[model samples]
Target: MMTGGLSETKSATPEIQDMVDEVKPQFEKKSNEKYDTFEAIEYKTQVVAGIIYYVKVHLGGDQYVHLKILKPLPHTGEPVELLDYQTGKTKDDEVTYF
Candidate 1:
């Protein structure tokens, strides 16, 4: 994959799902909505100074959200950050760099 370009979207693996779980609370806080069911469905990755994960999440039923999370380089000793997100997405929505 290109260094600065987004990787092809892929189904969420166990690792990806764990990453989502780590940031779920932050997402809920930012969106001001608690999702009873938060599931990571698919994702795209980009490599910068760190890794940027663009994840498509299922919030049960027809509801969905896109999350942009940053996992700093391991040596930075930084925590993964919930950078931005878009709500009202759907199962059919493509997970992009936004």
Candidate 2:
């Protein structure tokens, strides 16, 4: 019934920013650990039929993540490896965390 009330006036930007800031360090540390633990991984992907692409994540240690890479409709470019850490699995289409 009430539109743009006091509740709506209170912004979530700062709360989100603070939350991100608080967790950023922890996330960074964990990400660094993942990077350090897996250094011999490789990734491959190719765009097909517009925005969908076949993605292969080879985590080298012994695990992999395979998924259909897609962005929101009406974007551009195939799925590119923004951040890839591959482990060069012997078999194909399997992802494991080591």
Candidate 3:
């Protein structure tokens, strides 16, 4: 089974860095800062070396490990406050769960 695993990374030390650098300027010039760069996106994964890297870009959504950008999933349609049920903790408890 393909459990939900999606990690983003930005490493240009070998070559991707160079490519990102080259591409970012053009992208920024075209998009006019509507979105951040891959570097700004905070890449949290790693890519290997000695193999042709296959990068898949998503316009407004994201990508999965299998290089598939699944269609937009439906929202829960429930108010977040409805889910904030704590027995004793108050809303001002100074803790925010992700």
Best by TM-score: 1
Residues 1-98, model 2: lDDT tens digits: 12211111112244333333343334336446342222212222233333222233333456543323333234555332222223233544343221
Q: Which is the leading candidate under lDDT?
A: 1
Q: Which stretches of candidate 1 lie over 4 Å from their true place?
A: none
TM-score of each: 0.97, 0.28, 0.26
In candidate 2 the C-alpha lDDT for residue 31 amounts to 45
TM-score of candidate 3 on Cα atoms, chains taken together: 0.26
Q: What is the TM-score (0 to 1) of candidate 1?
A: 0.97
For each candidate, the alpha-carbon lDDT, in order, equals: 0.94, 0.32, 0.29
Per-residue lDDT of 9-85 in model 3, one digit per residue for the tens? 43325344443444444444554554442432122222222112222332333421111112222364421111111
Ranking by lDDT: 1, 2, 3
List per-candidate RMSD values in Å. 0.6, 17.6, 16.6
lDDT of 2 at 83: 29
Residue 28 of model 1 has an lDDT of 88
The 10-residue segment of model 1 with minimum total lDDT is 27-36
lDDT accuracy of residue 93 in candidate 2: 38
